[model samples]
Target: MKIAFYGSSLVSSYWNGAATYYRGILHALARRGYDITFYEPDAFDRQQHRDIDAPDWCRSVVYPATEEGLRGVLAEAGGADIVVKANGVGVFDRELLEGVVARARPGALRLFWDVDAAATLDEMRADALHPVLAALPDLEMVLTYGGGPPVVGAYEGFGAAACVPVYNALDPATHHPVPADDRFACDLAFLGNRLPDREARVEEFFLRPAASLSDRRFLIGGNGWETKAMPANVRHRGHVYTAEHNAFNASPLAVLNVARDSMAHVGFSPATRVFEAAGAAACLITDAWEGIEQFLKPDDEVLVARDGQDVADHLAALTPERAKAIGEAALRRVLAEHTYELRGAQVDALFKAAMAERRVAA
Candidate 1:
């Protein structure tokens, strides 16, 4: 099967949080005999900040961020077995969505892959005329990186023929434990690009704890926090490259996963960082959110925090031995139940079933 994936930069994680998810899932699909061509627009300086060169597993096309470039890619995608217009491509998104639905070869599956389903759903709910809502009826299926049952129900309500939540998972090959790096050493570390929807939560969950725990070192690695004021103990390392993520996750005594306001409210959405930290066998602390127990056992495989005080409390009691124990348990659980290989098999089955249903209908 051939897949034409139009998304934000697959070669860069600069301002694109979905890079890891894209790489993991697409790589797994490639191993399962799907030929993938990832089309990413040359926008947001992501081309200059690329974390990885194009991989042999998939052909990556960096198209100009222009109407002409989009038309070229849409024409090229006509032959694919599956045409995917992922959310937040950063340019010509609506055109790409409508293009794949209208121009994909007859019988080619048209998919809308939403890496940020919670935010997308919020937008759809606010505006009935959202372009995605208009495109849903024509799309074969809606695939989401997170946002479990709520997202599926919302999409179905919006007239999507089918909606499936393909949660983020560990790619052991890319994100397993590595020897800790001194550069990222910290008591608690968080790596997320500063964004409006997430900034307040980061302040509440990460910064507040840093202020309260004056003795414990904290590290923040992401773009846009360089100018933000932070406590003397907190170090802001702007834009840690994906190549160094394993070290970043491993060097920290505990890594924190703070969902965006929308994701937390939506309940079941887990950020890519959660799996990345667990994949590196790092003790993970996540802000309280519904459905986490379905992924990691709280206080055993992971620590759940209700607020900044909860985060501080966890650190206050954390011991090297206990952290190691929790991390190991997380690793075991993810390796057995939440790996990209397993996710790939699930995706393959979904694709097969959907194709069969389409054939029957035809």
Candidate 2:
């Protein structure tokens, strides 16, 4: 199958959090004999901050952030067996959503892949005329990276033919345990780009705990936190590149996964960092969200925290032995059952089944 994926940068994680998810799933699909051409706009300086060269698994096309550039990609999309317009392309999103569906060759499956389904659903609920809501019926299926059953129900309620949640999973080859690096060593470290919906939660789940445990070392790695106020005990490492992520996870005594407000409220949404940290065998401390046990067992493989105090308590009582034990357990579980190869197979099957259903209907 030929897949044309329109998304944020495939070569850069600079300001795009979805980069790893795209890489893992698409690479898995490629391994299963799918030919994928990733179309990403040359915007937000992501091109300059390329994390990996055009991957061998997929052909990458970086188009200008212009109307003409978008039209060119849409023209090429017509040749794909599956045309996917992912959320948050950072440019021409509305046009891309409508265009992929309209320009996709007859009988080609049109999929809208949402990396942030909770936020997208909120937008659709707030505005009846939201582009995605308008585009739902035209799409063959809505695939999400998170927001399991709730997201599926919401999309179906909005008239989508089908909605499948393809949760984030480890790409073991890319994210497995590595030797700890001094640069990322800390008691607790968090890696997330600061954004409006997530900043408050970051303050609660990360900064507050850093202040409460002033004696403990804390590190924050991601873009847009350079100017954010932090406790004296906290260190800010601006924009840790993808190459350093494994070391960043391994070096930290414990890594944190803080979901955005919408995700937490909607529940069942585990950010990509959860799997990445687990893949590196880092003891993960995640904010309370429903359906976490579906991914990692709490109090055994993972530690669940409801607030800053819970985080502080966890850190206060955690010994090096216990942290290591928990991390190892989580790693074992993800490697056994939560790998991208498994996710890729699920996706491949879904595509085949959807195609078969379409054929029968025709």
Candidate No. with top lDDT: 2
lDDT of 2 at 107: 95
lDDT of each: 0.93, 0.94
Candidate 2, poorest ten consecutive residues by summed lDDT = 263-272
* Inter-residue clash pairs, candidate 1: none
lDDT of 2 at 210: 94
Error of 1 at 177 (Å): 1.0
* Residue-level lDDT tens digits of model 2 in 1-362: 89999999899999999999999999999999999999999999999998999999999999999999999999998899999999999889999999998999999999999998999998899998999998988999999988988899999999999999998989999998999999998999999999999999999999999999999999999999989989999999999898999999999899999999999998888888999999999999999999999999999999999999999999999998999999999999999999889999999999999999999999
TM-score of each: 0.99, 0.99
Per-residue CA lDDT of model 1 for 205-293, tens digit only, reads 99999999999999999999988989999999999999999999999899999999989998888788999999999999999999998
